[model samples]
Target: MQGSFCDNIVRSSTKDAMPDSLGNYLIPTSYSRIVARELGLQERELPRLLEGTGLPPHVLLAGDESRISGQQQLQVMTNARRISNDPAFGLRLGSQLTPRSHGPIGYLALSSPDLLTALKSLRDFLPIRIPFAQVDLHEQGQSMACDLTILLPAPTTQLRMLVECFALVIQSLVESFLGRELREASIHFEYDRPAYGDRYEKYIHSELHFAQPASRVVLPAHLLTEANPEGDANSYAAARDMCAALLEQVPVTALSMTDRVKRFLLAQPAGSVNEENVARSLYISRRTLARRLQAEGSSYRRIREDMMAEMAAVQLRQGQLSVESIAVLLGYHDSANFRRAFRRWYGCSPQSFRDGVKPE
Candidate 1:
């Protein structure tokens, strides 16, 4: 792969980002080599799937080559999937397969009332689990859309299969949740059309766009408002609250809109921050900010409140600072207002949050 192209595919810190969590699930390069050997293919033919590129397959397997172009990596996956006949082979091979992996996201998506809601739930919940991939839900003409952007520091040698598997899993889960396939949606890829594009079309039963602006799956806008057969309003509310609390506690450990907002706040130590301020810093609009957060099943107000609560809780627990000082740290006008907000946040007064809870 060209150096520039490889740079685009991999993440900034490749060594730290490898998915080793899927213990027995990882089908390493050695495993692939074994499969190829069983099929009577020479080691030289291993990289043949990447016909135009002179790089060896071990570069991807051994972590020697830091990057691979998204296009080239996709091409290799398409060829490998075709030859291997395992639709889930790539994810099963690449990921750290574990019970705790991917978390409440699958449940939230399934429990949502409509396709839009399900997608929004995924957008909100995915960050707590898979930080490497950012998924967006947007309105497209009369339809709705989902964009899946993967952030990896190393060449995703099996990204094609990973994308296909994610698309399949999302589609299947949507159909299972709504009790029907997406009737008026389409799938799009940022990479070039591959050899198995037709198969993708047949599986999705929708138009497939290649080399698109981004990697996304589009659905009709009406799907957003559809009544969910499995809807449980109370449960969803509780889940949302729990997630909000989680976001406040450890913002940097995860990739989330909430976490991003917290990071932004930490970077700007002084002042009252709001959506417009955050949007300006991010180079996006207030309207776009609202829309994106809505897709994530949260609002700027919610994240802001969470940040304040967390800051207050931390200061209070330290017990070294007075209530007035803590209030100022959180950009409050006075202790009374900060106390009210604290009570609302933890169902107890600021004094209680300080004195009652044990350190985490």
Candidate 2:
């Protein structure tokens, strides 16, 4: 496996963070795709990524996305490192997890109005992507810091993989967002530098600082306000709405009467999924709908806003209409009113939301 790994590193060489187990958060198994592609693994060799994790190779290669438990993911990474015998293998993987690899989150980064907003979105929404990741943003006198607090119950090997991967992943993402290398930035790791990796200049753009209190990346404060050229009102709004809705929709299954109503509302057109229609769809009288929702500690109006926020996000992500057009479609007479309502729902201006949604 090590020989194949060395050869593959030379052949493929290119690829794709982590934290601890917080409340049984599962990781996407599609990471196997990154391993396979980056390691130049042949079709039959794809099983190498999941080898001893009790997860099958086909699941690793599954066209649809699948998730595995934290323990299972650690086992998989353990196998990856064992096979590679390269201390910096995780950094190699991080190089491939470019900003755009994150789907809606990628849209948020690319369409942000400025670098600071993009970084915040990355900070705010990353938990939705990687649940155990805790990124603390701080402003020092001359620079900004992104600190990752790891709470993983894993061996040093797995922890190394996690930290190294996160370091380079952030480096790649910020560079992509800023459209330049982060020469004035640096990454600090809590662990000592491995003998095999002294600089790791290829994957991480910033100067490397090891043996720190926490693993973090710091950049000059002046760079934070730089505007992104790709930003626009439409794309940013849509991307933001999509990300916010995705966050709201986590735990994916509807466990409450309120949740079930949200699911029902989301399945139908936005404007038509009103109180009466919702009651009808649930096969209940309006009064019963009211009573059950009240018992569930929710109400029709609150649930409707959730539905509308999600609908607006979906439309914004699709990039087929202007924010004003979407507002009207959702029955808002004034676009400014829609903007205010959207902010209340998602915590950003309607145009600001589009800054997170990249225009298609």
Candidate 3:
């Protein structure tokens, strides 16, 4: 990929700052199951692969309701690398991907009228499938490039695996759509060549370039207008609508601003719930964040207070921490301030609340 295109992808990817809170960006459990199946892993071996990932194999098998976060997914990738000992494991995984593996996004792309529309659908609906990454397409004179960027904090190995898997998956999808692979197509990796670098040739039949500035796949621009053999305009329209509806259900945009802010506070350490910090984490200016919260009939201070009160109630119910320690955990300067806040929140002192005495 061109250097300018790579730089644009990196810059745009960082513009939308995402919160690092656990479970902030979730991928459907079905995707995980697909990956495991592609790896030829047995059901019983999943736990060993996901040991330190804070993810349970049951969740991956839990149907469509369950989800895994970006961090946990990276951990799983790390574990997979360790167990498989195959540096090109990602390429192998990607080669196994079928349209059904992508859920609705895959189907929508499959039925689109042409390659370009299918790619556009993938770009628009990718967040619903994988929320922690963004894909952008750029068309130059004779070649078109699809750029992929991960938005979450991940280890280098996991990052490389993700990009490699995506590039291969896209290549497979396009070949399936067009009934053949483009001779001019190529895959580029931003990182240096690995010891098993030559193995990439086994999966990507086209030119493979390493140590490039970005992770991208370049294809002949004329391929964009080529009609998909299975294309049905009517089916594509329905699937596109369904994909749009699913995108709305993603957690980041599904919740109200107030609820989102409250969740952000719940995920942070005590005393780190100020407007500036929260706004920065959410990739919004202080004023815009305040306005949105206000539009939701709440404010940052109110949400923070609610979060603190909820946490205090849970802590008191657990009855493990003393009032003083609880106060400290809640960022109170002293027990007296905590007591005052408790009184304001629940009409009782901390001890009285902890003692099962109802405020009257």
Candidate 4:
């Protein structure tokens, strides 16, 4: 039997190149911090969990407008699974996630007049929450299905984590609006059953299916018209307006020089993305590259520094490598200098940061 209408969302590639002047494909850091918190990770433990993800610890700590790429976000999820030793971590994570956990998007959905309006708002503003995925809502006979398509390449674990978390979140949102769980709703996953698959029943009360063609959630069509008891048209309009304004800020551009540089850095091993080498790869003078990046609100030195700090924190958290080794890995010649820089980035010494001990 088919799972819920929103089941089996497929992943697809987009022909459009990376947008211009956009620092990178990013998702809100709030979501990452939420996942980390729910997984019981402490502030100091983040570096290890975020290792190799190219995400700066400060971004998550500051909880500002900063963003991390879809790839890095996936790395955090993968790390959480390993650290927590829970194969059904995603299911648990989703069950605890409230609409407000999504920030403005959550507010917008909560204020929507009905399920259909809420889903449409979610579809349109999804980019503001997770910029790397696309949502498609389809109408089937007596049912409505919402399919999720990820634009980035993801491993099996990352994909499974994302699909499962999203499915549960959607289910929770619908239940909140209906003031009860939709007994007729269901969930579907494209992957094979995991060893801990039985735990899914704990969170997903509806019918569940695996080894399907796509990942999606399905709901009965009649539920679409169910009025949200808390919905206020004025609140929804205000939230929607704010969401639209934010989406407009997302950069869109054909491949440009800035895009090329980011792509180059992502492909290279950590600490190897010096300006001279990057310039050589692009067949341009170092000065020319600097000028272009400056015009784009970025610089090679800034990018390299951010990348180095992110990788350094990750390595330190892993506990497998020494402080000296991590410094050299990031192209530093002296451990003393690395420690000083680490202090500036995270406001603490590397040792203190990695010990899962925070400075008072």
Candidate 5:
């Protein structure tokens, strides 16, 4: 019922990028406890964060329960980085979070040739870690860019500051892993600079932007192909195999029909989520799909509306497109209908929603 990075991390077209279950992708609770102790944080804080997010503390220890809110997880990640001074703490924590047999994110890092590739791999699979943020990759003339645009639950003004801090930490982590001074790039925050910006320069070693359009880290295009001195090909292959094996061991029963339906819908384009289309894709008749929905305490109409509401809210808040245009994109007949629907779903007009969003 709460927000989760897992909910939005898997790009609709790329379910394969994620492991079959939530448990397969999380950091172990033991690791979280250890990290908390190391950082001088109360062990209870970790559990509290999970609990606040409506998740059980046990989920942190076992890869079996596999549900985490992006917001709550951010608190843990930020705490780790602040305490350890290890920028790659996320990746390191990741290595222990997943099944030990699978090597966590360590395998993914090893397979990369250069820091660029490693960063790319991180972006692709980042949903497994940080799901609420948009990991964007863009290429200008000779430069490449990477940014995480954070989307918080509506009405959280502090979400911008929190997201900005996390973005800086991510940039710091990438540079720390390579042992290179990320000289070519700039770390831009959508919010204004805090007094902490000076300390940031020691770790980031690049221009830092405050009050920018989006929070981002830009890189040189040539750096992507550069070979990573520490990279290992064999370990990467082994890790992949381990992940696949672990995935095979997890029973399908761990997931609900709603999760299955959601996964299927994630694989489809936005407009193709109708009952008939979903039924056809599932190789079932419309009546069968309806019956199953009834059994599950949900209906096709409910799920579709939920998806649209989520999509509409996120796009309206984060993206720069206009209301009318967004309406068209969401398959609405016109702006008026979109306005009415948005009012019903959110209790406010789209413009008001946009105006209320502070930059992160």
Candidate 6:
């Protein structure tokens, strides 16, 4: 009843770069399932894949969806990387992902008339498959560069695997589209060459470059115009529409630290939300909470101040609560201090701001 605006913000953006523990599963279970199969986990051994994520075994086994959290999927990948003997686990995982495994996005790509159209679908809807991953297509002389970036935070090992897996997945799709291996394409990785660098040369037919500013692939510009022999106009239209709908549906699994903090804070009961409370709720130390927020150009105090101001405005605008009551709701211990803060924020008294009366 106190946080009307906060309630609406939480409800509307539950899936937007925020934690979704109580909402419908936003992350597709495909990646987790793949890790299970890759590990050759027997029915009883499946728990190894789900170690710290608090997800049940059936969730991964139960078809493609029945969704899981991003943390759950990341946990499984972490387990797989630790368990697998192969140092190139990410590349190996990428090679194993079939087009069918990509779901509607794969269907859209396979059905696209030309490579450019297919790549465009990736650029526009990669988030549908991997919420934190984004692809930007650009022209670099005779080559088209598809720059890939992962925006969300995760464990260093898990993050590295996700990047390698996604880069290879995209490369595999490009090869699938051409119906041939790419001898001239070059892949630029954001990270330095790994200990098992030879595995990349062995698996990736493309010319490989590492230690670059970002992860990207450079290919002959003419390849984008080449027709897909398996292209189907009707299927492409249907799958493209489906990708659009799916992307619209979940709002993407946002692993952004700031967004997660904001959503969690807004959803908590008014007086119970604060820096200590947030750090505990988010499973991070106070120092970590402060550091992550600072990286995003925000601090816990800054976020709380902004939210309090907005809450004050909303309550005042509704005229449902007196200025004193609104101040209490926004965590102010005294109305006089609240009035001073409000005046500083709006350059006028709260009531006048609420009444839309400007300072003369």
TM per candidate comes to 0.41, 0.61, 0.59, 0.59, 0.48, 0.60
* Residue-wise C-alpha lDDT for candidate 4, range 1-360, written one tens digit per residue: 122111211111121123224434567666776676676664566787788887756454421345666667788888888888888888877886667666556766777788898888778766666667677898989998888777767888877877887887788888888887757886878899889898988889899989988888988999999898863464344323323332233333344566566545543434545788677555457898899789989898787676667667756755666787667656677889999989988888999999877753
Rank ordering of all candidates by lDDT, starting from the highest: 3, 4, 6, 2, 1, 5
Q: lDDT for model 5, on a 0 to 1 scale?
A: 0.54
Poorest 10 consecutive residues of model 5 by lDDT?
94-103
Candidate 1: residue pairs that collide? 10-152, 10-153, 10-154, 11-152, 11-153, 11-154, 21-96, 22-96, 22-97
Higher-TM-score candidate of 1 and 4:
4
Candidate No. with top TM-score: 2
lDDT against the true structure, per candidate, is 0.55, 0.67, 0.70, 0.69, 0.54, 0.68
Lowest lDDT block of 10, candidate 3: 1-10
Candidate 3 residue lDDT tens string, 102-218: 655676677778889888878976776677878899987898899989887777887888888888778877887778764578888999988888888788878989999889988
* Candidate 6 per-residue C-alpha lDDT over 45-115 given as tens digits, one digit per residue, 9 for 90 to 100: 77777889888765554222345666667777877887886678888888777565665567666677888
Candidate 3 global lDDT: 0.70
**Between prediction 4 and prediction 5, which has the larger lDDT?**
4
For residues 177-294, could you state the per-residue lDDT of candidate 1 as single tens digits? Answer: 5676666668787777775555564566557788888778787776677776754544443333334344334533334554555555543332455677676544446887788778
After superposition, the stretches of candidate 5 with alpha carbons farther than 4 Å from their true spots are 1-38, 42-51, 62-65, 71-106, 154-177, 246-360
Which candidate ranks first by lDDT, i.e. highest?
Answer: 3
Give the residue spans of candidate 2 off by over 4 A: 1-23, 239-360
Candidate 5 residues 252-280, lDDT tens each? Answer: 44554454555444433345457775665
- Candidate 6: segments with Cα more than 4 A from true spot: 1-25, 62-64, 235-360
